[model samples]
Target: MKVKNIVRTVAAVAAGAMLIPLAACGGGTAADSGKTKITFLSWDNEQTMSPFIEEFEKENPDISIDFSYAPPTAEYIQTLQTRLVGNQAPDVFIITSENKNDLIDNGYVLDMTGKSYTEKLSQANKDFVSRDGKVYGQSISSWAAGIAYNKELLKQVGYDTVPSTWDEFLDLCKKLQDNGVSPYIEAIGDGADRIPDSFTGAILADKGIDVTTLASKDPQTPGANEKEAVKAWMKVYDEGYASRDNVGVSGDDAKTQFVNGQVAMYCTGAWDFSTFEQAGFDWGFAQIPALDKNHEQYAQGSPSPGLAIYSKLDGDKLKAAEKFLDFMVSDWSLEQRSKNGDAITVDGFESDVTEQYKDVYENNLKTGKYFLMTNFYSNPDVLISTNNAEVQQLVQGSITADQWAENIDAKMASAQ
Candidate 1:
């Protein structure tokens, strides 16, 4: 899911909550025209969701969707939470890794078990949003976070492609640095942990640990096996492959640096093609590097956010909600979403992804390593805030790599 999209149209790593007076939030009755009105709260800006909503309404005249108001993740969580506790939540809303636990544990989301639309859903999507083996959220699409390389810049260092292993990667970075080129940069100011996190998950996965299980657990927990992952990540900075000053850069700045040829590599996802393609230089993507020659690359991901219903919805309103979700995964909706740049989830959903991304997708096909590591952590703040802060410290040499790992382990333990 997008933590990748914050730089683009905002990709979805399926990830959100507050209390208010009943009517103040969304306490509307059915429409007088005999249409069942369902309120939808989304993390997507209204402009992004408008066309999809319009199309859904056009198809199902019996249901009307009300997007009273919705903001991005940080704020939407607070606003939606107040409404949920006040019994005024929108009828249809999003369930992400951050909010999945509270929503499912408190019975806020409807149980979607055995729904026909879910039959062909990917196990990755199902596992991300489910609790106790029952599905709750309808994850529609996905994207991956990886390294984007400047093909021309790397060519100056005599490399045709990004290296597959970390030790080799350091050599490449050194060659570029010696050539007066900054080897890599990522917007660490805004949750830039995805690159390191994805690579770490790959290392752990090759060790036979399913990172999804450890996602909600602290990495430094006794026997957790996350230490090696953190050590490898710290090496990229510790060994001078990337800059410590990157702590001040934002995602946009990283993109701009790459465009200006100020940097030879960038850590981000596929969403930035619109900007990158405009660059004067030739570029391509690389699977995230692994720990050594033995490990396979892994990228962080989750099913894109899908339609979810409030548990209390019933009768015609319930039917409408289910129908809307059904329609979302229908061939038409999947095709439309895929056309608009989403890497959709439904099996056999053909995507309009470009030749460049075809390589990225194919790299992970055999391993199915779309790692949803941080999202599996129940407290959204851990990935959104804490992990970033700790990673910054690791980069700036304020904390040892082990200390950073310990910080996250403690955070996860506290979350539990």
Candidate 2:
């Protein structure tokens, strides 16, 4: 999953303390074990990754994984950066949007350009971790976030599904509120707002605009495209269909509200399906509505972080790392990942994501009808941080949409 979706509460431990005796990979320091010990710094927690590690070790008896954990987004990046600088980088670790540029540009990650393991990856997954046609990481799954609505709640307003267009969506929100239901809740307090990003994708695609141009270090007009999208998205706040109080809500809080049946629709992804199932509520997931009839629907999404090997590795260590990556996309591993609710994007592999996620998985992830600001933008962390602050102000009625867009442009310019 992307940085925006991961929890940031885990403290990142120092890699120095966790490095095995075989930290210097080409050396035979662990010869006593008679197995190639591969050090892996995992972005996913131990609970989720242990099963895969166990299975891989059981199958490949000649290899051993010396595993360590660092939670995603900021902490993991910082920890990995420190380790790389100290010449103590793990043999394998996650390479995500937040650090792919640094890892590839600095020659810290191995290039898998013609690797057979990458042959199964979809184009979108390959592109996510590639630079200049050279692939660096092996990403297997992708995720899409869209409108998740309470089925029974929508029926109360005489609707069975979310509207297909933005205007109609707002009208439905109004009707839901009129019927004494909390219309919508999305966390605008953290990162970029999903709805406006989806709108931006639809608008850019409709106009045949390539997002990479706008995402460059020096765009001709920094926020020109986003202005229209932000304006369109502000209608939800301007019409009072959704509460400005959402500026303080978090993804967890929004999910809690949705589970309690306090809100009719919640903007999220399939990650919460297990919880929703336990909540005992009928729900449906749909692509975020289009900007208008002329535009197609889009969602906010990207490939999950992928496994990248340390570039300096060679000999036995390198072979072991490659074997681990190959095993990750093996049929057995893919099945485990699918069962864990990942929308597996490896070609020829089918994922059994929950029913509520099928529409989003098929129409959004499979079709590449999704966008993420971080995936496209240069200095992505700056853009997301600025966007979170700016959007909260926009919804709180402190800044007009024009001003909000200008502020983001100014921030992007200053950051460059």
Candidate 3:
């Protein structure tokens, strides 16, 4: 679970190569034409963005677009870094917790304070855009991750509702086990799910401590709060609810098992909805189960993926970039997004969520609950992504819980 271990693995892949060529449009460049062209570099591919891009282009006919995409998460960051260094960076790009600090430190991203678009989003969403009161990136949508369960499996075990408390959840798991169900399936091998970390977040929030603060603390310190959170995860391991064999199971495998009805509950996010639906199961979503009677419900997520203008652009191109970004956040843009079956990130935009998940969306909004996977502004390069696999190993019994906590601390220390 060391950061270097994962980083090396990713860096070994062709997709991990530092300087991927931007997808070139066959049309002429900005200098040749009267129109301004702005390149949009994103992790999402052209097909995923076709609807939004089409609408934006239609509304702003004068501005042309050059769209590009890289693979998700780590590879995307490395690709963007290479682009910035070579001065071939896109006019606009995604700024997430993984690369936000490095981009800010290098002065590659534009300061968006006082922009009209920044004011258009909800205040809560706006909080994510600013660092030291200077806005940089605007989150287009919010996200949350939790247990998506197979309803029929639960009913077969004589349960109608997903458990709310950890104890009840454990009881339900036992029941599912008694009835020959795999109770829960977590992605231990993927090294990113961090199921234990999520349960720890809920535990910290329950104790009236900030989950981010807990994460920010030195994991090696072993304070009372840290121990409590660690103990919450250890309970799952000690009770045999989770397995060490999961250390070899990837996220896709877990999803497949859940979809195949091999497991009752799968820990994941709303992003997995399409995968599950395609899996063809009678499934539904729920918040992460509470840790205890006193614990408040909580779920882990990432900041809405944002589109930010790169600092290097100027003149008509700058104006074009602004126009494109504005269109991206506009109501018209949101409507198109809804129609295309994209996930909702903005407050007022309607979602393309399946009818079965309407209640899940409503409940998340009603509770005002969210926890980012990485704190974009606060600890951008702190190696939060590598801890999941280690935690998974601990749950699956490949590694001890103490070793998992220590591994996280080691990564944070190295990053510092």
Q: How well is each residue in 1-416 modelled by candidate 1, as lDDT tens digits?
A: 35532211222232121222222222244343778777777767666667777788888877777765555564555566767887777788888766677787788999898897676677667767776678888886777766788898999989998888878888999999999988988787766756555666666666676434554444435213455666777777877878888888898999999988889999888878778887757888887777677766777665676567999999998888888788878887778777777776667765767776776665552235666555565665554566677877877889986787677777767756
* Ten-residue region with minimum lDDT total, candidate 3: 1-10
Instruction: Assess every candidate by TM-score.
Output: 0.85, 0.87, 0.80
Error of 2 at 176 (Å): 2.7
Expressed as tens digits, the lDDT of each residue in 1-416 for candidate 2 is 33354332224454443433322222244542788889898878778888888898889878888877765666778788888999989899999887887897799999998898888898778878887778999999898888989999999989999999999999999999999998998887654378877887778788886654554446534466678888898898889888899888987888999999999998887777778989888988888998899888888788888999999999999999999999999999999998876789888887987777788888888876777766766667777677778888888999998998789888888877
Model 1, global lDDT: 0.71
Candidates' C-alpha lDDT: 0.71, 0.81, 0.66
Better model by TM-score: candidate 2 vs candidate 3: 2
Q: What is the per-residue lDDT of model 3 for residues 119-227, given as tens digits with 9 covering 90 to 100?
A: 6664435545555566788766656667888999999978876788878888888888888888887776766453444455556556675333333355323223344
Number of the candidate with higher TM-score, 1 or 2: 2
What's the distance in Å from true for residue 104, model 2? 1.7
- Candidate 2 residue-wise lDDT at 332: 94
